[model samples]
Target: MAATMPAPAASGHNGRMLSTYPLLSSQIAFGLILAVGLYLFISERLRVDVTAMLILLALVLTGVLDSKQALSGFASEPAIIVAAVFVISGALAATGISERLGAWIGRAAGVHEWRTIAVVMPAVALLAAFTHHVMVTAMMLPLLLRHARDRQLPASRLLMPMSLAASLGTTLTLFSAPAFLLASDMLQRAGTDGLGIFSITPIGIALVLVGTSYMLGARWLLPKRSGTHGDDDYLRLDRYRTELLVVKDGRWTTRPLSELHKALGARFRLLGWLRDGVRRDDLTATSPLLAGDVLLVEASADELLSLHDDPGLDLNAIVRFNDTVSGEGAPQLVQAVVAPGSEFIGRSIRELDFARQFHAVIAGLWRREGDMADRLSDARLREGDLLVLYGRPSRFSDLAAHHGFLMLVPFAGEAKRRVHAPLALLILGVTILAAATEWLSAPLAFLMGAVAMVSTRCVDIQQAYRGIDVRIFVMIAGVIPLGIAMEQTGTADLLARGLSHMVAGWPALPILLVMFTAAALLTQVMSDAATTVLLGPVAISLARTLDLPPTPFVVCTALGAVVAFLTPIGHHGNLLILGPGQYRFGDFLRIGLPLTVVIALVSAWMARWLWLGGPLLPLSG
Candidate 1:
């Protein structure tokens, strides 16, 4: 009779399950939308913002959410703060604050390479703590390039480290990264105390210290690509091609070419030697030099300038990229680096025939490969390859646009409104103080700061508008609704239940650790903001299921999303340095793997200390 009772209960359980399945119809539709959304985001088949719009539309049509909920994200506080940050950061850059900071960095660095890294990286981290990470990285990029060139330091060594520091800065403040802002917004919407402006400072300071120390110590692990050496210094590296005539004053008439090469010593490369207007084909290291022989020498501007001191060689017509000859009119000298996704990658200058197509001379090629001087015409171009071209100014622009090249030299936009830099800095300080003291909300404080920037002419209104990244704004506004729909449709609960079941026996620390780890893994393939949006609801629900405060869990997830150290694509800051540093994908993994592990452990522990009390997990009654 007892066994028969069990069969009836089993049938009743099955019937209840069937009823619940029917009631979860909207949940099932939301799930399909989510799957497709994640696929579109990860595959990048469509623009992220466009994909987000589609997902929001699907949610409304499926009746998972009303139009109000979907559109609310556009006016959300987090989105406002994000857009304001761009304007503020642009003001800082436009008003010469960043450039002023560069001067301070240069002063602090003196002449030591290690000093530069120590001063610059931490300073960059601190500035980025309150501004856009990419703006900090981009504004400081040319400064570092110039500094590195002046000091004759390897650029690759400093660029990756700087980019990494920009990412680390996000951990220091709630508003520094979109992920943290979104996380804080989620916490507030849950009726919990949100993260303060500097809530993450304790853990952030520790991580920045660890990151800076690790980079300095693990310098050996960083790639030493010197092909891009001396990029910004005028005529610093292999930029001059001139004719040097062997003269009789020093009696070089019987000397071999080997002696000339040995004497030049890193100053120049021998291209061709001509005697009596005839190019020598039999030229060898042992070939005898003639008194009246003209040697085509490739050298730096400075190196060629100093050659006037040599009595044995007379400086003839400076044939720097045939600057003296022009079919397209007065030639302009421009330095261009290959942009990302360029078709020029893997193609040689000889194949493109710049001389025929644009009538431009590919005078110099700087690559990370280390041996680009001898084969400028035949060397295959790679992303980040810096080329010095001699051509008409208009043609240079057209060619750069046609090819995927970013002109870095003769850039007219570096003009900074230095007079207003002080005002900009003061405004930034006031904004931070207001938010930190709770005098005004973060969004309001930052928005006020942006307005002040325009009013003070720190950044013109047009510049402020241009600074705003429309794609990110649209993406955040669109995807915030997805998180809302997940909660509305009970999808967040479903995921929370499943995750809880997976970690049922886990202690408190591991739960936080798992959240952090999951965030870190998801962000490598998607933007950090998107990762936070998708994970924020799940995290909140998971903490609720464990009967714990959601702050630690949410904060942990944000920290994980911020590091983005594992790959260049993980963050725009990383991508900004990719070509300049000429780092391979594996370089990020090698350096970032250990760094990511260290940050995860420290951040999880810190979250436990700061937000959680005694138990890592709540004790079951």
Candidate 2:
């Protein structure tokens, strides 16, 4: 009779399992979308923003999320704060605040390589504590390049350290990186008080001190190449070339090439002469020019455009390419690189039509693995191709923000609104105060600052738009829905169960070490924001299973998601320095491995103290 009762119980259990299969299938669908989205983002086949949109569409169309939920990420607090931060940081750059700070570092950098690094790394870190690191890096890269060139310093010595410093600096503040915000949001959703602005200050300060000291010793590990070593090197790197027509009444007719040099001075170099489709390959300075001949010249983009005002020379085929070389606005020179998987990869610059697309002209194109002297219009761009672009100062900012390329220089010209520096600083200070004091939330405080910047003309509406980094906003917005799906579909619970089982019966500290290692390794290829969202709930769930406080695990997971020092692609700052620093994949592993270990240990210790209510190392009598 008891055996008969067991048969009924088994039947009931089987019925329940059959009923739950449809829900499980939906959860798996959302999981697959997340997997595909991450693959596309890391592969760089589509831009980050575009991949985000695709993820959002998948969630809504599959019924895992409704239309409103899919779009909720745009309305999230973190997205608002991030967008506003872009404008505020732009104001600082536009008002000359970043330049002024950079000059202070430059004055200290005189002659001694190590001394310059000591000052530069700390100062950059300090600035990053208060502002966005991406903004700081963008504003500082060109300034550092110009400073290094003028001082005859090696860029290899400064760029990697600066990028590393910026990455560390972001950890100092709650609002600096999207990881922290995501962690806080997760905690609030789990029915706990979220992280405060200065909750992690002690850990941040300790890491900065150790990191700064470590860099002093690590400087010898960097490559020692100089960015602009000599005049010939500069011309080769710039790769600026154009054809000029010798007019009938122009000064070059019947004159020696030496005479042309006498007129243009050191500004331009005559490469060769072309007449009736025949080229003179080896022309000396004494070679004579004739009317209607075409001269292939090497010059800066600025010098090339300044020719429009000169009567002696006119741009060859000026009628067909007038819009490009006509000198229509304030001229500025910028360096940008075609990114991997760029739509521009197989297209020529002439076909892409920069003048129509970006309001800019392609002055030259450089491929690191190929000859630098290739004709600009004829060269099909490949990944890592450095482009020398000329355009108006205002327009270059938008071009710099394009998803197809990475901007090496911030802008072609300095911000003309230097007088607004004080006002911009004041606004920024007030915003920080408001957030720290809890008078307003992080998003509101930053939005107010952005509004003040535009209203006071510290940055105009157009400049504010240029300053906005749409990729960051779109990425955060799209990933938020996926996070929601994780919780709603029981994926978070399933992951938590499996993870907790792996470390069952472990001590609290050891458990934290296990979780931190997993999060850090995942962060190497995945974004910090996405990593935080996925791991935060798992940490909380694990804590519940172990009957331990969840805060320490949550904080550990968040910090681990941010320490991506293993590869250049792991961090945006790393990618920003690749061209200027001339770094390879091996370079990061060499310098980053030891540093990552020390940081992980320090963070684990801090987590034990803050959440466990005891020191990591207990003293014995």
Each model's TM-score, in the order given? 0.69, 0.69
RMSD of each: 14.0, 13.1
Whole-model lDDT values for every prediction: 0.79, 0.76
Candidate 2 Cα outliers beyond 4 Å, as residue runs: 1-15, 145-153, 227-414, 616-621
lDDT of 2: 0.76
- Weakest ten-residue segment in model 2 by summed lDDT: 410-419
Identify the candidate with maximal lDDT: 1
315-406 in candidate 2: lDDT tens per residue? 66452354764334666556788888889988877788877777676655556565433344666888988776666776766766788986
For every model shown, the clashing-pair count is 1, 0
Kindly report which residue stretches of model 1 are placed more than 4 angstroms away from their true locations once superposed. 1-23, 227-230, 233-415, 614-621
In model 1, where is the ten-residue run with the lowest total lDDT? 317-326
List pairs with backbone clashes in candidate 2: none
